[model samples]
Every structure is written in structure tokens, then in C-alpha cells.
Target: MYKTIIAVGLGGFIGSVLRYLVSRLTAGVDFASLPLGTLTVNVLGCFVLGLLTGLFERTGNLSPEFRLLLTTGLCGGFTTFSTFMGENFSMARNGQFMLMAAYLIISLALGFVLFFAGYAFSAKIRL
Candidate 1:
């Protein structure tokens, strides 16, 4: 039990740092269109989650701590669903309704695609 807590905390910390780095690098990379930083992390996190889930499902013997660390800790901290919502809200409030809507559609659509791709790829690269 104690180990699980440590695993989750450590994983969360790493994931959060990685997320911050990604955000920093993508900060000024504006294509003058979408929130690329958040989109990138969210999609990447989703892909990783999907791949791990696939591998876990295939093995069915993953440690509980590892599972929590990867999913609850890493993915949770890495993906910014709250940030995504906030971005949408901010864009809408600032009267960028169309951009907000487009961002939502593109993010959701691409996220799903990348996640599926990762999962499918995992099936082929079984551990």
C-alpha cells in the first residue's frame, strides 16, 4: 500500500514535469489557430494510456502500483482535461466561439485517432 502511494506520487511528479516542459516548448509556437500545447499533451497522454491499457490487458498480470502509477498518476498529471476546458471557456468568453468549437472538434477527433493507433500498435508489439 505504501509502495503504491510512492509509485503514484513519483509518477505524477514526472508526468507533471514532462507536461510543463512540453507546454514551455510549445508556448510561442502559435500557428495563430489552436491551443497546440494542450492538444499535444492530451493526445500524447491519451496515446500512452491506450497503449499501456492494451499491454496490461494482454498480460493481465500488471502490478497494482504500476497500474496506478502509469494511469492515475502519469496520465492524469500529463493530460490536462481541465486545462482544455478552461481554454475552451476562455476562447468562448473572448468571443472566439468558432475557434473554440473547432479546437474541441479537432482535439477530440485527433485524440481518439492517436489513442486507437497506439492501442493497435501495442497489440503488435506485445510485451
Candidate 2:
């Protein structure tokens, strides 16, 4: 428990710093009204989460502390909504119609549906 807490705290700190750096870099990159940092982080985070999940499943040696570090620490630090909005709008501006449409639909649809499913599953277990 102590290790998990420490791991999560460390991960959160690192994630917060990385998020700040991304925001700063994107701000300087004069690209109309779209945000690049948020989108990049979200996509990257999702990919890493997938990879980590697979790795954990395969290894089966991941401790609770490590899980906290990867899922709660790293991912928690990596995702950003402000950047997502900026990037999405930027895509719209650059006439990447398909990309923008796909991103918007997939992000929202998958996010909501997954959240609901997780919630429902937990509720069932509780009952």
C-alpha cells in the first residue's frame, strides 16, 4: 500500500510536468486556434495504456504498486482535454475533414460507452 501510494504520487508528478511542457510547446507553435498538446497526450496515453495492459497480462508479475504507477501515475499524468480540444479544432481548420470527424466521434463515443460499461460491471459485482 505504501509503495503503491508512492508510485502513484511520483507518476502524478511526472505526468503533471510532462503535461505542462506539452502545453508550453504547443502554445509557441502558432497553429491557428487548435490545440496540439492535449490531442497528442490523449492519443499517446491511450496507446501506452493498451500496451501496458497487454504487457501486464502477459507477464502476470505486475505488482499492485507497479499497476498504480503505470495506470494511475503515468496515464493520469499523460492525458489532457485542453490539448484534445485544441488539436481537434486545429484539424478542423486544416481541412482534414475525415480525421476531425473520426477523432470526434471515436473519442466521445468510445469514451462514454466504455465508462458506462465499466460502471455497469462494477455495479453488478457490488449487487
Candidate 3:
């Protein structure tokens, strides 16, 4: 357990640093009102996670620790959007269309609502 945590923590640190650098590099880039830096990171993270998932599924030789370090730590720190997309992909692949749609709708709606709720709450505090 401790070893797993350490592996994830180290990977998270590396991934976060990389993310910051990427963001800085693309700070001024934008397309169609979207932040290109974030779009790049999220798409890259999703591709990496998908590639790793396919390889792992094929090989099944990697240790759980390494997997966690890459997926749950690195990809997670880079962008949780990858995880969300990956989950939806998996559900679709498994033919769970209804559940996938529900998850997609609920997550997006509730996430936006919670984000604004938090923002409004913070603004109200004004401290």
C-alpha cells in the first residue's frame, strides 16, 4: 500500500510539473474561444491513457504499481478529463449506452452547477 502511494505521488509530481510547463508554453494559444493548451493536454492525456489501456489489456504483464503510477497518477494529474472520457469510452465499448449517456449528462450538468455554486459561494464570502 505504501509503495503504491509513493509511486503515485512521485508520478503525480512529475505529471503536474509537466502540465504546468505545457500550460505556460501554450499560454497565449487559443482557438474558437477554447484554451488550446488545456485542449492539447486533455486530448494527449486521453490518447496516452487509451494506448496504455490497450497495451495493458493485451500484455497483462505490468505490475499494478506501474499501472497506477501512469494512469491514476500521471494521467490523473495531467487532466481528469481523460479519465472521464475514458470511462465513457469503456461504457460505450461495452454496449452500456444508456448508462453512458446518463453519466455523461449528469456529470456535465452537475459539474457545471457545482462549479458555479462554489464560485458564487466564494464570491459571497468576499474575503
Candidate 4:
């Protein structure tokens, strides 16, 4: 339990840092007059989670602690809902109606699709 906790903590810390760094790097890029940071992190996190899930399954036995570290810790940390919300709100406040709408639609649709695809792929391998 302690090991799992530690692994989660470490992974979360690293993931959060990476997210921040990416956000900073893309801070200058104005995407439809919205923050590109949140979008980048969400998309990257989803892709990484999918890849990691596949790799983890094919590679062999992984301790529960390691799984927790990668899935709950790294992926959870890497994705930023708060930032996403903030960006949406900011867009609305700035009167970027079209951008806000696009962001909301894309985020929801793509997120769901990616999640389902990841789950389906993982399930297929398991079966």
C-alpha cells in the first residue's frame, strides 16, 4: 500500500510538471483565440494513456503499484480538467463564442471517442 501510494505520488508530481511545461511552451500559440495548453495536454494524455495501456499489457506482469502509478497517477495528473474549464470560461468571457463552442464540442466528442477506442483496444488484447 505504501509503495503504491509513493509510486502514485511520484508519478502525479512528474505528470503535473510535464503538463505545466507543455502549457508554458505553447502559451504563445493562440488557437482560435483560446489557450492551446489545455487542449494539448488533454489530447496528449489520452494518447499516452492508450499507448501505455497497450504496452503494459503486452510487456508482462506489472505490480499493482506500478499500474496505479501509471494509470491513476500519471494519466490522472497529466490531464487537467480545471484548466480545460478555465479556458472555456475564459473564452466565453472574452466573447469568443465560436471558439468556446468548438472547444466544448471537440473536447467532449474527441475525449469520449478516444476513451472508448482505448478501452476497446485494451479489451481486445485481453481477450
Candidate 5:
């Protein structure tokens, strides 16, 4: 457990640093444009994570540590949006259109609702 935790921490640190670098590099002289930097990283991260997942499945030999380190840590640190998109994309590509659509709808709707709920709850807390 400790090893997995440490691995995730290290991977997360590396991924976050890379994300910051990408953002900085892409933010040059752009104050009124789309967030291309974030989109770029998210898409790229999704592709890489997809590749890793496919590789693991094909090989059928991988440790939980790898998943924790790469998927939960690296991709998550890089951009959780990528992971969410990737999962939906995979389902759609595999002909699980209904599930994909449902997941997307529920995830976005519930995410927004829950986010607002948390914010309101926190604001009301008497601490």
C-alpha cells in the first residue's frame, strides 16, 4: 500500500509539473483566446492513457501499482478531463453508444450539481 501511495505521489508530481510547463508554454501572449493549452494537454493525455490501457489489456499482465501510478496519478494530475473523455470515447468506439451517452450526460449533470452543492454546503459551514 505504501509503495503504491509513493508511486502515485511521484507520478502525480511529475505529471503536474509537465502540465504546468505545457500551460506556460502555450499561454504566451494570449489573454483573449481559447484555452488551447489545456485542450491540447487533455487530448494528448487521453491518447497516451488510452494507449497504456490497451497495452495492459493486450498483455494481460500488469500490476495495480501501474494503474495507480499512471492512470490515477499521471493522467489524473495531467488532466482528469482527459480520463473522463477517454473513457467515453472508448465506449462509443466499442459500440456502447447508449452507455457512452448516458455516462456523459449523467457525469456532466451530476458533476455540476454536486459541485454546486459542495460549494454551497461549504459556504454555509460555520467554521
Candidate 6:
């Protein structure tokens, strides 16, 4: 457990730094209301995670710890959106179409609501 935690932490640090660099690099890119930098990272993260998942499955040489470091830690730290997408993809692949649809709807709706709720709560705080 401790080793897994450390692996995740280290991977998270690296992934987070990469995410910051990517965002900074694309900070000036504008595309209407869409956040280009975030979109880039999320898509890239998803692709990378997918590639890693396939590679690991085919190779079957890497340990679970390494997988955790990359998927749950690196990609997770880079963009949780990728993780969310991955979960949905897994569900779809497993033929849980209805569950995936429900999850998709609930996640989007609740995520937006919680985001605004947090923003509103923060605005009311003095310090």
C-alpha cells in the first residue's frame, strides 16, 4: 500500500508539472468559449491513457503498480476528465450502454452544478 501510494504521488507530481507546462504553452490560444489548453490536455491525456492501457494489456509485462502510476496517477493528475472518459468507454465496451448514458448525463449535470455551487460558496466567503 505504501509503495503504491508513493508511486502514485511521484507520478502525480510529474503529470501535474507536465499539465502546467502544456497549459502555459497554450495560454494565449483562444477558440470562442472553449478552453483550448484544457481541451488539448484532456484529449491528449485520454489518448495516452488509452495507448498505455492497450500496451499493458498486450505486453502483460508491467506490474499493477506501474499501471496505477500511469493511469490512476499520471493521467489522473494530468486530467481527471480522461479518467472519466475512460470509465465511460469501459462501460460501453462492456455493453453497459444504458449505464454509460446515465453516468454521462449525471456526471455532466452534477459536475456543472457542483462547480457553480463551489464558485458561489467561495464568493460568499470573506477570507
TM-score of each: 0.94, 0.62, 0.61, 0.80, 0.58, 0.62
lDDT of 6 by residue, 1-127 (tens): 9889988988898889988898899888875423456555665665576556546645667878888998888987887576567767887898988877866665666545544454454444443
As a whole number from 0 to 100, the lDDT of residue 37 in candidate 5 is 60
Give the candidates in order of lDDT, highest first: 1, 4, 6, 3, 2, 5
Residue range with the least summed lDDT across 10 consecutive positions in model 2? 118-127
What lDDT tens digits, residue by residue, belong to model 2 across residues 47-104? 6666565556556577888888878898888787766677678888989877788777
| Cα deviation of 13, candidate 1, in Å | 0.4
**Ranking of models by TM-score:** 1, 4, 2, 6, 3, 5
Q: Which ten residues in a row have the lowest lDDT in candidate 1?
A: 27-36
Off by over 4 Å in 2: 30-32, 81-103, 106-127
Clashing pairs in 3: none
Tell me the tens digit of each residue's lDDT in model 1 across 9-53.
Answer: 988998999999999999989855788899999999989998987
Best by lDDT: 1
Q: Superposing all C-alpha atoms, what RMSD in Å does each candidate have to the true structure?
A: 1.1, 8.8, 17.3, 3.2, 17.3, 16.9
Alpha carbon RMSD to native, model 4 = 3.2
The residue-level lDDT of candidate 1 at 32 comes to 59
Output the better candidate (1/5) by TM-score. Answer: 1
- Model 4 residue 41 CA deviation (Å) reads 0.5
Against the reference, the lDDT scores of all candidates come to: 0.91, 0.69, 0.70, 0.81, 0.67, 0.70
Error of 6 at 62 (Å): 0.7
What does candidate 5's lDDT look like per residue over 1-127, in tens digits? 9989988998798789888888888976453333446555665665556656555555546788877888778877887576567777787798988777766665656545544454444443343
